[model samples]
Target: MSKLQNVFFPLLAVVAAFIVGAIVIAAVGDDPLFVYGLFFSSVFGTIDGLSYTLFYATPLIFTGLAVALAFHCGLLNIGAEGQLQVAAFVCAWIGFTFNLPGLLLVPMCMLGAVLAGAIWAGIPGLLKARFGSHEVINTIMMNFIAAGITSYLTQYFYREPGDPILQTKHIYEQAHIARIAKLLSPLGVDLPQRLPLNLSLLIALAAAGGTYFFLWHTRWGYDLRAVGANPAAAQYGGVNVARNIVLAMCISGALAGMVAIGEVQGYRYRYYEGFSAGYGFTGIAVALLGRNHPLGIVLAALLFGALQRAGLFIDIFTDRVSKDLTVILQATIILFVGCEELFRQLKRRWAKPA
Candidate 1:
């Protein structure tokens, strides 16, 4: 595929999904243009809206990159959901239990999250490498295991006394990440104080940049990609295929773990039960739409983040259309992108040979 096709294909998929969405809106007795305007405005019109979009995008960015990294290694890491859950729990556990100063506690919590996620994901990776088991099955099983274990642990050990909620105690203040609103107050940009946008956004961006560098510019990345392209060939060429497989998953899990920084430390300040809201699964869509590139992932994450932020307004403003329309649109985009090969074949059949 050409560079133009790389950029054009995803954009075409997005436009096609929106076109279908507009038709659905019209069928529901609403003006498609008006509904779309409301959607766009709610996500991008004001500072609060944009901040919320960015806040939502932060986790998607991490999870998207995580999936992309594994995808590059010819692996489907469906366990990102589980990995992130475990990581969030570990991070929250550290935050609530530790009494260190801000500088010490924050990084320690992050490290805990990363290690927890890596270990959770590494099990499936090890299974795939050592036992020749399929990662997809193992990762899916791990998601369920992670969910059950985390729920049990939270209820048994961390639940606030007599509260009846499945969540940990509130984290210490020093462990909390500073919200971007507060950080910008000194610079005269008066963002909404309540918005969840935080320093984690910068961390997410840094992760993207680092991923691009690591994947395309480093020797280790080449070996990983080589293993993905052809494990037998890579091994014949002296690359350690098994090691790279495990390493790829470890790195993927670490990236997914970063989501906890935004959700647990930055916003909730607790490990709330079932707080994921499907960010990990949505990340697969984001990674596919982004073509597994860091820059593309950021843009795709922002688009999905905006859609999430807009869903509430769509529910309130439209008569017959519900927030479920966003789900439909997302599904449509995924369908179209996944069928790109079919479209390309049809295009080829219609074109003259050079």
Candidate 2:
């Protein structure tokens, strides 16, 4: 019954969101059915569309897992945005500065990204452990600091000479990850040569599997969840609450940093300023809708990715409806999911003896 509810409620929320979205489309004097048909068909009807959707989903998977891990530790990690940004900068720095072979440079850049993100996130974690300062405030402040610092560093050191763009030099070919199109060529499945889907999708899948294993099948995960559920009880049971807090955030940040592998190594091959179109923030909604499970996160990320792809078609094909309708639908889904606990409480209250 609980498992059924878990699936049913999210499905309910998604359906509600679409219903509301259809109403909005009608208000705009558009044919909601036609618009939605185009939207869905564009995302799933073609191979190129599916590839693009998966490419967009890749980073969301990383960020969503990052948020889910921190939530398991009773922490809200809003700093994933900053963590990803700094990690991308470091990855780009290593990619452009090094001339090593692909085998060596790829892992080297990845390690740099992970370490940079972990360290940046560790500061707030340490503060929360030592001073009892709220991680939320500290993480939010860290985002601003990270943005300013990265911006200054990119302008001062990484930006190409006389180039107005605040971005690093293009990474060498040695650091590039092969695109999905090339990989599938051997199987005779022809994909668009320029599709952005790449090897990082595999990394995202691996991270999800690793996260599931770490949280459910490991002793450390046991300790972490114990601390999250009840810190006093966990401390009485000999779990070091403070240490777990810091450790969880570090792991979360490391996962978030994997976004760099997709953006820098896989697609753009450089650190572009403002490349993140709120993927970190959107990840909160994804995690909530997914109920913090790896399989659910994958499904939720794919939905959002499809919405993103569909929004473009809506703009081009619909006369009255704009892409903002997609934003409204996303917000509605978040709202319904966020209120789920309240609904559960109401149901319980109404069912009580009266």
Candidate 3:
């Protein structure tokens, strides 16, 4: 029943959100069916749309996993945005600074990104474990600090002289990763070279698989879950809560850091200051909508990815509807999902002794 409900309630929330979204579309003097059909058709009907949808989904998967991993340890990691940003810079830093071949340079960038994110996230974890300071507050503050530090570094050291953009020099060609279009073209598969979809999607899927195994099949995962479920009981059972807290945050940060693999090595080839369009923040919604499950996260990311892709068509084709409707729909979905928690709390209260 618990497992069924985990899936059922989320599905219910999505359905409810769409139903409400449909009403709103109609209220705004548009045909809800046309709007819905356009969104679904564009995202699913065309190869280009599908590619872009998956491309957008790639980063969301990384960020979603980051959030989910922390949730397992009873930690809310709202700092994935900052973590990814720092990691992206570090990854690009390695790529541009070192004149190594892809074999060495790629691994170095990945390691650097993972380590940088882990270190940044670990500070909050350390404080939380040592001082009982709230991870939320610490992580939130860390975001601003990360932003300031990264901004300073880019402006002072990384940015090429006379370059107006707040970005680093492009990584050398050796650090480049292959796009799906490039790989498939050799096999007579027709795909546009302009498509940003790349090998990072595979890495993201692997990360999701790795997360599932780590959380379900490993001892460390068990300890993390135990801590989350009942810290006192976990301590009684000889689990080191402090270590798990740090470990979870580090792992979460590592996953978040992987976002750079796609953005820098695979697509942009440099650290763009604003490359992320809230992928980290949107990850919280993905994690929630997915019920914090790895598989669910991927599916939810695809939904969001499709929504993102659909928005362009919505804005260009529709007369009364705007792309912001997607935001409204997402907010609606989140609200409905939140209501599930409310319902559970009410049920618990009602069942308690009067």
lDDT score of model 2?
A: 0.91
- Top TM-score hit: 1
Instruction: State the lDDT of candidate 3 residue by residue for 1-354, as single tens digits.
Output: 499888888888899899999999999999999999999998999899999999999999999999999999999999999999999999999999999878998899989999998988898999999999999988888888888888899999999889999999899888888999999998999998999999999999999999999999999999999999899999999999999999999999999999999999999999989999888888888999999999999999999889888989999999998999988887788788878976577668999977
* Highest lDDT against the true fold, candidate: 1
For candidate 2, lDDT tens digit of each residue in 137-205? 998999889899999999998888999999989998899988999999999998888999999999999
Ranking by TM-score: 1, 2, 3
For every model shown, the clashing-pair count is 0, 0, 0
| TM-score result, candidate 2 | 0.95
lDDT of 1 by residue, 70-102 (tens): 999889999899999999999999999999899
* Alpha-carbon TM-score of each model against the true structure: 0.97, 0.95, 0.93
Whole-model Cα lDDT per candidate?
Answer: 0.93, 0.91, 0.92
Where does candidate 1 stray beyond 4 Å? 349-354
- Enumerate residue pairs that collide in model 1: none
Q: Judged by lDDT against the true structure, how good is candidate 1?
A: 0.93
What is the Cα-based lDDT of residue 321 in candidate 1? Answer: 90
